[model samples]
Structure formats: C-alpha cells, structure tokens
Target: MDEGRPIFQQIAERVENDILSGALVEEGQVPSTNEFAMFYRINPATAGKGVNLLVEQGILYKRRGIGMFVATGARERITARRRELFVLEYVAPMLAEAASLGIEPDQLGQLITDQLTAGRLSEKETR
Candidate 1:
C-alpha cells in the first residue's frame, strides 16, 4: 500500500492489474468485498468502495444473487486507459525534457533503441 495515495485507489488498481495479467478473466467471479476487507485489514465499506469504482467504470458487473464478476472487454478497456495515462504521465514529460535538452525526436529514438539493445545484451550475459 502506498502511503501517498488512497487505499481504495490501490485496491482498485490491484483488481485491474489482476485482470490485465489474465488472472481474472472476463465473466470470472471476483472476491467479495468482505474478503478484500479481511485480506487487507480494511473496512468492508472501504473495500466495497474500491470495488464500486470498477463497477462504475464498466470493468465489473454484479449479479443479484452472486458476487461481482469481470465485465467483457474489461482488459481492453484497462489497456487503452493505461496507455493514455502512460502518454500523459510519462511520454509527454519525457518529450518536454528532451526538447529542453536540445535532443531531437530522432535522437531520442536512437537513444531509446541503444538503451534497449544494451539491456538485452546485459540480460543475455546474465542468462
């Protein structure tokens, strides 16, 4: 749990991560809010709030007699949203910094490629 962010948000992200990683497939049941509360030592209401965030986002759905389940296309929705966030939070800032340093887009591309190649070589050496 990150002290800097709300616990409920972290809880929601954990479920999203699970879905994105294929641990929670579409239509698969998710743990109850009570179970989440017990696991994280949080209030049931707090856990439900986290779960509800996904419900509101269409990432999950509820059945009257059953617990929550992942919604169809949830993984795709999460991936698209995360990609947008990545560009907003990381790529934009990196681009601005590169411009400030007089690094052209082409130079940045080459630098990125170089780093990736170096990383692959290092990984191979370790293996």
Candidate 2:
C-alpha cells in the first residue's frame, strides 16, 4: 500500500481482502484489536480503527464475551463491497488512464490477468 494512503485504510483493506478471499469466513473468528496491534506492531487504537471499519461495514460482529467474528453474510458482503469500490475507484480511473495513454482497455486488462496468473502459478510452484 502507498504510504500516502491512511494506515487505517490499508489495514481495513487488508482484512477486507482476507474476508473476501475466504481466509476469514462467515461466523469465523477474527483476531482481536490488541492482537492485531501486536501482530502489526502498531497502536491498538489504529488496529481498533481498522476493526471498527469492518464492524461498520457489517463484516465483523461482536460475540458478547468472545472476540469479533465474521458476520453471517460477510464473505458475500465483502465481495460485493469490493466490486463496488473497484468500479468506482480502480476501474474507472484505469480506463481513463488507458484512454489517455492510447492503450486499449483489453490490452491493459490482459496484462493484469497475465501478471496475476503468473503470480499465482509462481506461488503454487514455490509451495
């Protein structure tokens, strides 16, 4: 993540990506705010901010005595939310940039697809 982006936003996005990708599933437990703070060596307040972002988005739910858990529809909700953000933030700008650079949208998309495929294959091979 770019340093210019807020740290809380980055942390929130990371957790959201994990949930969307099924690393964090519906009804599954998530690390506590303090745990996240310790794990990332950041202030607990920062971690809480990230976690609270998820809570506000209906991604994580409190369990009374227990820690936070992913919401029942969290995976789908995360996916849809990200898809919405991608269109509004990533896709539109990238399309505009492609036009500005005289690069075909299909070509740029192919490059991204190739890079992602190669990245996954490399990760699998290494594992």
Candidate 3:
C-alpha cells in the first residue's frame, strides 16, 4: 500500500483489481471486514469503510445474515467505469502533452503503435 493514499481506498482498489483479473467473480462472497482487517493488520472500521464504499458503488451487496457478495455484472460495470477513468486520467493528459509537443494525431498514433510493438517484442525476447 502506498503511503500517499488512504488505506480504505487501497482496500477498495484491491477488490477492484481482483474483480478485473477474474479472481473475484460476480455473486462471489467477499472477505468480511474482520478478515480484511486481520489480513492487512488494520482496524475493522477501516476495512468496513472500504467495503461500504463498494456497497455504495453497487459492486457488492449484503444479505441480512450472510456476508457481502459481489453484485451481478459487477465486473462489466467496473470495466466500463475504469475505461472512462482511463480516458480522463491517461488519454486526455497524453493528448494534451502531444499537442504541446506539436505532434499531429497521425504522428501520435504511429508513436503509440511503435511503442506497443516494441514492448511486445521485448516481452517475447525475455520469454
């Protein structure tokens, strides 16, 4: 966990990462607040705050007696939300930088393609 962000946000992001990676499926039971607290060595209230954030976002739901479970279509919903965030967080800033550098759209496209291709090639070589 980075010291820069709140622990609760980090906990929420951990669950999001799990859902995106298929480790946590829709309708699956999530770790209880106590479980999270024990695992992370944090307070139960802090863990509960993270879990509640997901509940508010419709990512998780609770049964009266049972624990929280991942909501149906949570992955799809999260993916869509993250895509929008990616555009705002990454793409917009990249485009702005490219414009400031006087890079045309086509030039920026080619640069991105080249970088992607190089990365793929390097990965293959490492393997």
Mark the 10 consecutive residues where model 1 has the least summed lDDT.
Answer: 1-10
Score each candidate by Cα lDDT: 0.97, 0.87, 0.95
User: Residue by residue across 21-49, what tens digits does model 1's lDDT show?
Assistant: 99999999999999999999988998999
Q: Model 3, which residues run further than 4 Å from truth?
A: none
Top-lDDT candidate index = 1
Quote the positional error of residue 29 for candidate 2 in Å. 0.9
TM-score of every model versus the real structure: 0.96, 0.73, 0.93
Give the Å error, residue 41, model 1: 0.8
Query: If ranked by lDDT, best first, what sequence of candidates would result?
Result: 1, 3, 2
Residue range 80-127, candidate 3, lDDT tens digits:
999999999999999999999999999999999999999999999999
Choose the strongest candidate by TM-score.
1
Model 2 over residues 13-114: C-alpha lDDT tens digits?
888888877788789999999998898888889889989998998988899889999899888877787789889998899889889999887899898999
Distance from true position, residue 115, model 2, in Å? 12
Which pairs clash in the backbone of model 1? none
- Report the Cα RMSD per candidate: 0.9, 4.5, 1.2
